[model samples]
Target: MNNSKVFGSTLIIAGTTIGAGMLALPLASAGIGFTTSLIIMITLWALMAYTALLMIEVHQHADNSATLHTLAKQFLGKKGKWLASFAMMFLFYALCAAYIAGGGAQFAERIANFTGVEISGTNATLLFTLLVAGIVIIGTATVDKVNRVLFTIKVLMMAVVLTFLAPNVTESYLMSMPIEQGLVIAAIPVIFTSFGFHGSIPAIVNYLDGHTPSLRKAIVIGSAIPLIIYVFWQLVTLGVVNQATLIENQGLSALISTLATTVHQSNLGQTIGIFADLALLTSFLGVSLGLFEFLGDTMKQRGVSSSRLAVGLVTFLPPMGFALFYPQGFITALGYAAIALVVLAIFLPIMMVRKARAQSQLSHYQVAGGNLALAVTSGVGVLIVGAQLLITAGFLPALG
Candidate 1:
């Protein structure tokens, strides 16, 4: 129960949760109104929190530290293992692509603003990838230290943006917009993606040496930090930028560009640009680290060489290729990634917990609400999946 360990683990969870997905929040919820968006945010936060706790419970039941792949195989057999691995890989790859595309755009914009020289998105992606890949290749210990610093800078930048925009945010902006029904459903996936901390649960469990109370506290506190940050962010962005403007602009870059023009402040725009790049960078480190470690471990278990370079290639190349080809699909990538996340984070946890219960193997830390909670959580997961499918099929209109 070392306090520092708890704090470090908490930072890991918070850092992972607050990433590129956040850049899509204001746009996604724009049509839904700020008040309804707030309610939706709180609801998704509680749902994700519960699912994350379930993941920890499953992890603690293991004799030693095991990943989602291992847990799925042990509890749900080969089919489960295959599905879990595919979902995890797809989700991570999609997220990596989204971050790469986002980081490159933000980085390129910052460069152009400062120097008046334009860099192509593909070139920016390659440059940013190579830079962060070096730090990621060094290993998780280095990543943890870097993440701490980056996380602090990210929070401060967010504060600065909010502070500048605070005066412009009126009660009218917060309360005036009408909630659009279909748009709210569309925003749920984005909200889920924003609060996505479950992927880091196993890493945190190992980090804290399986101390349940400390791990639980870290999850709760870490998740709550983003919840607070998001609320204020929505307030500022929705307050300053109108709903129609968000819908028209329709992506992270456009949103920020609009903010700058609307606010008539160059410094504010620069601060937010820097903030976007830092946010994506920190998340890239956490996610790439997770993917690298998972692949390296799986390779070792299969009696293969898990060298740094080998794992780095496997971890980054596909996402890099995708980002290169589809450099403008940041928010779309996150939305699709949410489908895979629901499978891995939400649906998988409920199934795992139920199987563990059936086997009479319980952990010291169990998520309460029992079968009813599982039913509700699973239903919510299914509904999210449905929304994603309908959106993908063009049955429901896509939100920003």
Candidate 2:
């Protein structure tokens, strides 16, 4: 394998994994405390890594050009294709809505802070949506180049946050237990969503020219980058901001505003806002590109015109409408996304691997652990879905 491709693919996986999700992480895991959250993070990282290899395992037996749609159709038939379609649509739209809600508010906040001229939340959302839509319509390479710059800025901002908070950040908060145990269960879905670079597996495999060992190395190291960064994030944010503050302010906007003043560095909050904007923008570019392509494919299948501009319009409509009415759409949409991801990311990969293995006539690359591994991973996915359902229905305690 060319070493350069491996490095590029590694960045792709890492960039895709680290996104606006970090803005939501502290709030989600705040009540559960850092230690438990760390355990959960590591365990889920392994599970996500395992499923990604399972994805590659399926690819080895299938066509190199196959997408999730083709893979599902080939392995699990038409019904499975339909199911994957619905789940992908749901998960992508939810994420688009989320970035709009969170990223737009931050944009508006930044504008008002600097210029003293307030932008309406809806207008801000519209502007950001159009920005992403335009870039995605241009092409993938544009998005890739743009994301690299934003990711670089995001890293710098994160470094600044750590520096500002370092003097006061304590490890004690990492040791703090949940005020109520149920928060641990409640935190699972959000945390699960954080490790979501699985969607990039097929693309990365293709990018690295189907070299399995290189692909495996890319997956492990790429996923691990976000894990280490998240650990630092949890340490700084949780160390200073107690559980009560996270509970009191459910709105991301409100919570971030509090952080600005809480940390006593006058510019720290603004720095964090810039960090979040880049995160949201990078994530939006990725998710929008995926949805745009998926929707374009659907339109072509149904004999509709799949022009770039026309498809882009249809892509943003649903999620934009949701953001208009649901100002709190960021957290709400992410919660809904967690459930859809359980189907799209976890269960589908497991089912495809099972079917592919059973039908293979010759030896090929396998991900190890056989049937037992799939069963265990699927079980965890099920638990995450159940936990999310409980949180949605108000049966479980939710910190934010």
Candidate 3:
């Protein structure tokens, strides 16, 4: 029974981490070579784990019923509540957009490969948007079960890919020099997005029933798994492919496709292509289901009959519309969305940590470093993220 619970929680953590951003990490790392990117990966991982712990700890101050709203209100007052709410909404929608767009791309590429009849990226976007929405509307209790199966498939396939890809990677890729704007504000959004550390706040807190210590432990352990995966993935990609190919293809999937074709044959390449499509499809579905569940819970807390369809639309529309109207805009929006999540994950949580301390005595797990240093670190993270949003939005240039 204990093992089952642990496995379930681990799957939740892994599924959350492997969302839309996994599709983008290869693209983000391509511009800056692998070695420098790996350092940033570890730094962001630490920051994410810290903030996640803080967020979960804050929930302990109140009951499990306390939402991000209550937590923000208690910690940072009205302004903080408003900002955190808006950022959370924006972050989820923006993330959904990335999932919608990437899933469509994956679906289109697979169909074209299999049937030799191309579905344009645009049509695939609409088709998947509607299909995933339908799945959410049906209210399947088995979604969690489906996720376990899908997560298994995803991990096995990734392991296979890494096994073949890792041995071919060399030291040259790991020591690549840092370019200008290597860790600048512009890069902040993508880095945060790739981490997928946002939705974990409520997820972990609720799972632990607002027990501060357990929540903290879960967040730390939960986040560590993804951080390791991201680092391993970056290393594998850098080692296996040349810098030029990674840059030109713009993502790891492209590299995977090329590598499969070169190492095996077109048939083997097509199999991996299908596997990639399946992985993205299931990842998006898992996220949509989780968000929909959150919305349902929110409504239930208010004594309202939650319409699954409405919740599904809430999950689907912002992203689907973005996918349909502004397919090309998804990547740019993703960077901004990542920065937005950093606000939701880091800033609000840090504020909550202070509030929790002020409200009561600190638990053993909640006591981290000195309060002053934590404050400074959280503040710097927020500023860096905000600056990245500005840069991504074209208000500032990448450092030269």
Candidate 4:
């Protein structure tokens, strides 16, 4: 049991899960209210943790160096691999678009404040993506070292912002009831995506050399860190800001301004601005690294010989195009990511494990509860996708 390896893996999971999604949580959950949001987050954490363990179970039967692309190809055949590929593209692209839309606007605003230069949204997205894309193309080590620094700053600012905001919370606000039952359904997509670190599970397994004990400890502790931070963040954000204000401040910039007014701490806005800017960059780097790896792997598997810049283009372009057209898609993009994640994170693992059980030699490690538990997990995935469809069709109301 190498403690350092497990600890590093834990931070990867925590860092990946705790980024831009934090920016959207208070607004998305506002319609459903704090208590309901808290319950949903806990339930989803259990589901995500369980699925991550299922991935470990699958890893037991496969080579640890196997990425998701290799595993899907070996276990489920071409159609299955293609499905995994599609879902990964959808999820990663949506997330990149989200970070760009959210972060680019922040960048543009900050620039205008400091230098009186107003960058347009598309230019901002392009510039912001260019800045981070190089670090990603340089590869994982650079991204990891940079993300560690950003993640640490985010944690410290998160603590300070929570401290300032905590004293102003009204108990009644914390207990506010859902404005509409349907909004609870809508909030599921965003909240579900918030727990996404399944993208980095293979990386974790490889880091620990497929040591089951270390993998289990890393996944549990890594994921739990984000859940704890989210609890405190939700406590402060939802408790201090009323439902009407949450509704009014639909955009992140507006929300920060609202907090400044509501909390009356002059520095509160500055703290939140720094925290959010760091959050967006760290999350972008994390998700982009995942995309970079996934895309690079796919290209190699297909014998597509390409340079790092080529891979970077494929990884960053579609999202930049999306952000270009619909510049304020932060929340909407997350919803889309959640839908694709239902397939990538939840359904794919269920299929792999079931197939592994059938064809491979029985491994010592298996997720508790047999086929019934797998079925239940798949069922929950269905519900999340369905909820998103309802929102898309205007059958359910989602907060901005």
Instruction: Output the number of the lDDT-best candidate.
Output: 4
> Judged by TM-score relative to the true structure, which candidate is superior, 1 or 2?
2
Candidate lDDT values, in order:
0.84, 0.85, 0.69, 0.88
Model 4 TM-score, 2 decimals: 0.95
lDDT of 3 at 203: 55
Output the better candidate (1/3) by TM-score: 1
- C-alpha RMSD for every candidate: 2.3, 1.7, 3.4, 1.8
**Candidate 3 RMSD to the correct structure:** 3.4
For model 2, residues 1-400, the per-residue Cα lDDT tens digits are 9998998888888888888887788878877888888899999889988888888888887766678878999999999999989999999999999888888788788789899998898898888788888899998899889987987888898899888877777666667887787889888888888889878777787787778899889988888999998888888877877767766777777777767778888778889788878888888888989999899989998999768989988899888888888867787688778889889789999999889888997788899898888889999999999998898789987535
Runs with alpha carbons beyond 4 Å of true place in candidate 2: 138-142
Reference-based lDDT, residue 70, model 3:
76
Q: How far is candidate 4 from the true structure (C-alpha RMSD, Å)?
A: 1.8
Clash pairs detected, candidate 3: 169-239, 185-388
| Candidates 2 and 3 compared by TM-score, better number | 2
